[model samples]
Target: MDFGILGTLEARAEGRRLSIGGRRAQLAMAALLLRPGRVVPVDQLMAVLWEDWPPASARTQVSIVMSGLRRTFRAAGSESEIIETRDAGYRLRSERVRIDTLTAERRVTEARRAMREGRTVEAARGLRAALALWRGPVLGGLDVPGFAAPIRRWEELRWRMAEELAEAELALGHHHEQIGDLTSLVAEAPYNERVRALLMTALARAGRQADALAVYRDGRRVLDEELGLEPGRALRELHAAILRDDPAVGGPDGPARPAPGIRPAQLPQAVASFTGRRAEMDALDSLPPDRDRGSDRHLAICAITGVAGVGKTGLALHWAHRAATQFPDGQLYADLRGSRGEAGGDGPASANVVLQRFLRALGVATADIPDDPEEQAAMYRSLLQGRRMLVVLDDADSAAQVRPLLPGSHACCVVVTSRAPLEELIAHAGARPLPLAPLSRDAASELLRRVAGDALASASPAEIDHLAEHCGRLPLALRTAAARLAARPRPAGDGLPAPRHEASVEALEACGCG
Candidate 1:
């Protein structure tokens, strides 16, 4: 028997399926599927089923629905006590059942890790295996209350995985092979800057730089007419790079250049002693693909908004590194300098300037790009309308800054890291808001171990715990502290107290005040 919750809700036994009966039961299953193996309170379940108001016999109805689901699982040959009643409410025992969602996630995660390690062949294989698991729109047959969020989330993941798979192919130099899929993706998400960017890259790589530049122009028009926004910095830079034929910027012939002001999404190799954030890592990993399939001009944006040093960039980069393969055309990252700058004119790079650079990277000529910010944006978007790419915009100050940079289509996915909550993006643009918090106690400790190694292993567990707490479990703070310790001249054999533990603790405590 197989129980799949990755894409859609399904229970099948030897090719035969078990029915969920009604929308209520389906909704219950969907809710459980959203957070498998975790106990969901009955009240929460009721809210999911009825939205605002529950019927008088909500509890009794829930019990009855759960009982039916349990029976269905049994009849479907799932003998591992699929659902168990708990003091809190109910917990689903998913052991021994084949869950497509879990399987897909595992496959994609493995692929991401492989790509990080430079194991391109293995990453490609893993991505293909993961993509093969999708049957249809996840939970396609089920219509239930509270299903929208999970469903959309799953679909987003699916597309993201597909994008990664395509990227892996691109890394293997399979540009022409990906053209078909890229075409469809571009058609579906016409406004996705990343997608258009990738398409341009692919075209350039396939010996069609002219076609690539043309794609950017088309995308530019769409953005101007529809959303009144311009292409982002990455796209513009790509165009310029292409025009200059800059081999250093990951263009056709030169050494692969890293995006300007863009650091790797993952921790630097210099800071190996990192710890905690398994859940955050998982959440980052679990972030669904862009979920705008209906409109060709769909723009899927995920804004990681939080306070300073909460590890927004860390989480974003980690996931981006893992997901780089999905955007085979290329991975583009930019730091908007939203957080750091002085009063002088030498402030963080502007959106228009960034766009210009991105366009060059994709093969746009400098002269072809206009001087006016609006025209530059339009030209930049036109260059990126039909590709599969991942664009990370870090430290955005406001939606206005980000709005102009959003791609004109959904063929690409954009991850924006910001300190403030972008309500307009979420409410108006369907951008999912992922609020990053501090690491959990365990995650914080693990981070410390990764960084400091056995040096801190023998230290008092309580003290270590206090230390993690003192850092507020923020990845940046923890990293900074760990870096300071690692830089010490003392040998590892020396039994030295963790330097600046008290000071670090005090600083962390102060962070809480803000």
Candidate 2:
């Protein structure tokens, strides 16, 4: 079935436009589409329709609307088969439904790949195609409450894509052709320095040098008048270059020009809600600063070892993001799963595979990578010999798996996160062992409040501590227990939110933990 929620809320089953009736029908459809292949509770559906003031007959009304939607689909020959009524609520059975926003995001991913491969023109074209999916205001006129957030997010993504496309176009001297479009964009986002910078560059490239300088003056005045600040470093540098007519400003050999530097910024996106690990972050930051050991041997290696669910990888990633500026070249990451727990899923990644990836990130050709493991390790170290870089080896099951991948150069910093303490890596390689433990009592409480809303706000301080103890102060376990307590239905006839103590008790009893 073709789903067209990007603009109008419409679905086509078997090539025919299935007619949807009224506002209630649209709301119901929107709710289902928000989470396809899952049941949306009837009460949750009622809340979405009439938030704070639900009628006494709200349940009956929800039933009526659902029945009407089923009849509408059945008449269209889609037959209520697509919408199944589960014990909790209604479920949309179609997993094959196509959503336009998902399509656009996939295209954005493709464009990112093109940029990585030095295909900026193709990246620009791909971005334009992705932005072309929107017909008008997304989810327009539906009035689906809480739907605005996702729409706003998508619109933000579209604007970012446009900015990226403009960047690529300007790099390829598509500046003259895009000045008009950019002018309108600058008017809309008056304070966006990037847009203004590109516009100035475009004007300068078009031989309107005076206009380009004037743009910088106008932008400076606007920033002082409104934001009480100056244009940022990039914009300021561009202005200086335009004034001096530096050949590099809008030249084909401008900024972001590919170089042979082996900066491997491959660290995965950091966890947004990473709670607390201040001491560990500081320890990793202070990686035993290189001393004059009478030799140039000073590679700072921090091995973060902990039990399962102790958040070793999470801490490593969060700190890596904070410490990214220190390693300007790049941050390389790999999951070296050693010690096969079974026949699959736990085996260590071979050193050759990891070196191949590292070598490529360092701009080495495939044919140039050495075949022997020792040779690969030697070449990897040689490339990183004099450069400052950060390498993260995560989930390493054993020491042997990590030995061959360590850089011999002291200029780099390597962070290894593992469950077992790789004693050999420490004894032989001088890795600083930072043993991570479960979250403390206070931090665990903060995490519970973060996950389960303000349930812990008015509860007894003692109660919060007791709940944390019940979960052994483990973040994963506390989150699970808090989730159940939060989902409990409020007590009958009490309008105000109830205390979490009773809910926690109920959760404990139901858990049946020995």
Candidate 3:
């Protein structure tokens, strides 16, 4: 079955259009197509068909709609059954279904590769083909509430693809040809600073410098009035360039981008007062071995899992810094925010966003970055080919979240930290599992001494042991307690500071020692 959800909720098999049922049927079909091959529960279909207040007969209605859809497909003489009825839900078989949206995604992925390899013309054509897949708004003419979010997302992707096309045109010196289309895009998404920049570039390159300046002024007005904002730095810089008639403003060579062969050094600072994880450090050090496995080798992955405040990030950072010399192409790091176990914190990092950042660091132009996650991952892997780089993903939530950010080169090594074991990675991706336990009492005491210095010099062994035990020998809690003790000097009348158990408890609470 050929599914068409990019424009309308329709399906065809063997060049024959299947006559699907009414709005409820369209709603159910759209839901199934959105998640091809995944079983969508009956309740979910009902919810999509009838939003919040699904009637008691909703189940029967859904069954009827599903039956109608299946009968239509059967009449179309599809060789393989497209829809399968699971125990609790219905699923569209991926092998039997070819979605236009997914095909577009694949096309975008190929286009990104072509662009990276300096095939600007082929890249432009591929991007245009992908954008053309969207006949109109997704599920055009559908007013179902369930369709709103996906439509908005697809529309945003379409605009981003257009922006990429504009960039490719500018790179190929088709600036005169792109001015009209870019102007239309600017009118549609006035707040899109990227489109604004592209339009200005096209106009200036086409010998319409005054007109390009006018476009920037119009964008500035729209942004200020509607969003209470000025144009972004890129736009402001482009405007300034046009004002000075800079020759580099819109040359066929295009704007300044990260040059090829430029190495990116993006690793964060290692823990300065880091302490104790000798066994774990040695295991991490073994990830990038000296053995030669020919040209094509698997990427080395190491996952460090442990309870909160068990120093997972500390161990990963310390080891990455130590192994920095092994990866000359540079290191990549991202706090996945997976362990943001607090009342209010940033959400888990998206693999696509991380890939975009990595690509930028590796010298890919920001305007040229693809919006599709698969495309981003493909481009990232292409960039890492034959290069020795270290990728550190900190506080990952799950294996699924970490998978896309991984490079597809044996020369690169990845280290991930998470509270969960991420068994999926270890089981499938051959990631070495390094489960971190809390520090021993001796290590905890030493860490305190290292952090506290003279603050714990006057303290007795018994007192230090008691404090370490009280903090469960967790490095974070121990460091917090020691740092707090050092900062607040409390003399115990005998030329020594008191190692109060109550103060240690307060420190543990402050750090949320789990």
Whose TM-score is greatest here? 3
In terms of lDDT, model 2 sits at 0.75
In candidate 2, what are the lDDT values of residues 1-514, reduced to their tens digit?
6666667787777888887778877888887876668899998888877877889998898888888987877777663367788987998775556667668888999997665444567788899899898777776787656677766777788778878888777756666777897888888888999889888887877777788889889999999999899999999998998887765454332322112544667999986567888899889979834534534565789889876666788899999999888887688999877534533663677766787678768766433444466777888888887677889999887788787778877877889988888898899888999999889888988877777665445556676677877766665566666776667655544322333455554554554320
lDDT against true structure, model 3: 0.83
Q: Write the per-residue lDDT of candidate 1 for residues 81-191, one digit (tens) a residue.
A: 778889868887767566787888898889887765446678889999998887777777665556778788878887787788777776666677777888788888988
RMSD of 1: 21.6
After superposing all C-alphas onto the true structure, candidate 3 shows an RMSD in angstroms of 11.1
Off by over 4 Å in 1: 6-8, 141-145, 248-514
> Across residues 1-514, which tens digit of lDDT does each residue of candidate 3 receive?
6889888777777777777878778888888877877999999898898899999999998888988888888888876678899978999888767899888888998988777555667889999999988877788877677767877888888887899989888876778889899989988888888998898998887778889999999999998998899888999998998898665564343543456567777778887688778888889878994547776567799999998889998998888888898998899999888966443676686677678778878877555666566887899999998889999999999999999988888889999999899999999999999999889878888888898777778778888887887778988898888887778776654223354555577898898762
TM-scores of all models?
0.50, 0.50, 0.56
**Which residue segments of model 3 deviate by more than 4 Å?**
1-258, 341-343, 492-500
**After aligning candidate 3 to the native by TM-score, how far in Å is the CA of 372 from where it should be?**
1.9
For candidate 2, the per-residue lDDT at 267 reads 92
lDDT winner, 1 or 2? 2
